[model samples]
Target: MSDRSGIFAGEDPFAIAQGWLSEAEKIEINDPNAIALASVDADGLPNVRMVLLKEIEAQSAPSGGAFVFYTNYGSAKGVEIEQAGKAAFVMHWKSLRRQIRVRGLTSREEGPQADAYYTSRSLKSRLGAWASDQSQPLASRTALMAEVAKVTATHGPNPKRPPFWGGIRITPLEIEFWADGAFRLHDRFRWRRPDPNSAWEILRLNP
Candidate 1:
């Protein structure tokens, strides 16, 4: 048996993830929720960028355990996600020396939840989403500003969520948690399950 005790002792991986995130929130300097989101292009080249994870959803069987984030549907990441139907991300907390990695299938989350999130954003950000043709080349910053101004006037206050902008939910098949340890050895645990409703099998890996 492995000496997986203390913070790693948990039947629910999601609970452990939540606890780690809570600790990270207290110690991180900024953007505690920022994750390195990874997606593969049509050519199989990997692309990664920092994106804020909006939510860790926990629901009943066949409909649970997803990481949520929003972006323009036409963006490079979005196109990759739609084409591949899968993605992965890593969240690292330097202060805590801990990291969480996830790989999963992707689906669009463009219902009331998307609408509510859109409404919660700052007016400028909401307007910016409407103004930006993300992943497309722009001639100049001035042109972008002009587009923003035009959209601001056209959409006005109480603007609706754009059809091209919404949320993507990732339902993970695997998640790994890692923490720093002394003597150049680290603590690592992986939780894997075939589907959300299936029982998770935990494995302790050498570090």
Candidate 2:
């Protein structure tokens, strides 16, 4: 473990990640939970976008230490994730001068959990999810809003979660934490495990 101490001290990487996020929340101007989600397309080209980290699932039975986020299943990111079944993301906090990176396998979260989250959204947002064909070319904003209105009238107040819209859970195989240090040097720690239930091997890397 290389005698990791101070902010990097922790047996559980998930807990450490949550702690970093909590601290970032206090100082970040916006979207402290934002992550740059990365995936590969059919052509093997990389794609990335800023997405909110909805939940950090820590130490669970089926999978341990996963991050959760919601999106349209047919969206660009969703298509890439579904095709690859794996992804990586980085959460950087400028104010805290820290960044956390993760590489993981992914699976859809389209069960009751997805339903609950969908229902919790505002009525317009819920309808908009159905109306917007994310990542598709739109003729105009006015056309999109018209479609939104149509969906609102059709689905009414209580719209069920769309089959094509839900959450994705990423179970990380590798996680790296970086913190700023003096003289352009930095502190870096990597935690890796073969599978979700496997023991983590921590390493300190030169920065």
Candidate 3:
């Protein structure tokens, strides 16, 4: 019947992703959750950067499933996401020799979930979030640290989440899992849907 076995065996793509991430957490030397997030600006020029994926919501989530990451809403990528309403990312684990690619709809997650994550950060990080004008040209390191000092003095130890910062969730229309194989041939399985509410159609692709 279906050849999807071992690491590729899972009914739900989101579940498969979470399981893979859990395994990576044990052996990945660094940030196992890092993703190369891709977005496009108003001009249609593409941009991509590495960002830590904060969470992977399961299929039971209200939005079905989503990959979440936080950043300054005023940042370039944030502005692009707001403009385009879509984004893509690839989470590659060099240690595990595997990767997950996703492309989908984007939305702001600025409610309680955002607040809780913001609150979980270290005090300096919280203050730094308030201080830094992300993706903007800065005068120098001195200027940045000066601003950090200023925000630290003003916001104190329990600085609240900055108004310009929160989570951005990408609800994928397509999710693909790929693993390294012997002899340069790779195993790939793509799960795609027409829209957020549609059921996924799975396909095994050529290497």
Writing each residue's lDDT as its tens digit, candidate 1 over 1-207 gives 257678888676777888888888888999999999999999999999999999887644345778899999999999999999999999999999899999989999999999999999999999999999999999999999999999999999879999999999998899999999999699999989898668788899888
Q: Name the TM-score of candidate 1.
A: 0.95
Ranking by lDDT: 3, 2, 1
Candidate 3 per-residue lDDT, tens place, 8-102, comes to 99788999999999999999999999999999999999999999999999999997999999999999999999999999999999999999999
Given candidate 3, what's the lDDT at residue 181?
A: 91
* Candidate scoring better on lDDT of 1 and 3: 3
As a whole number from 0 to 100, the lDDT of residue 158 in candidate 3 is 89
Candidate 2 per-residue C-alpha lDDT over 56-169 given as tens digits, one digit per residue, 9 for 90 to 100: 877753556788999999999999999999999999999999999999999999998889989999988899999999999999999999999998889889999999999999
Query: Total clashing residue pairs per candidate?
Result: 0, 0, 0
TM-score for each candidate, following the candidate numbering: 0.95, 0.96, 0.98
Cα-based lDDT at residue 40, candidate 2: 95
User: What range of 10 consecutive residues in model 3 has the weakest lDDT sum?
Assistant: 1-10
For model 2, the superposed segments whose C-alpha errors exceed 4 Å read none
Q: Candidate 1: which stretches are off by over 4 Å?
A: 59-62
- Residue 188 lDDT in candidate 3: 93
Clashing pairs in 3: none
Q: What pairs collide in candidate 2?
A: none
- In the predicted model 1, the residue pairs found to clash are none
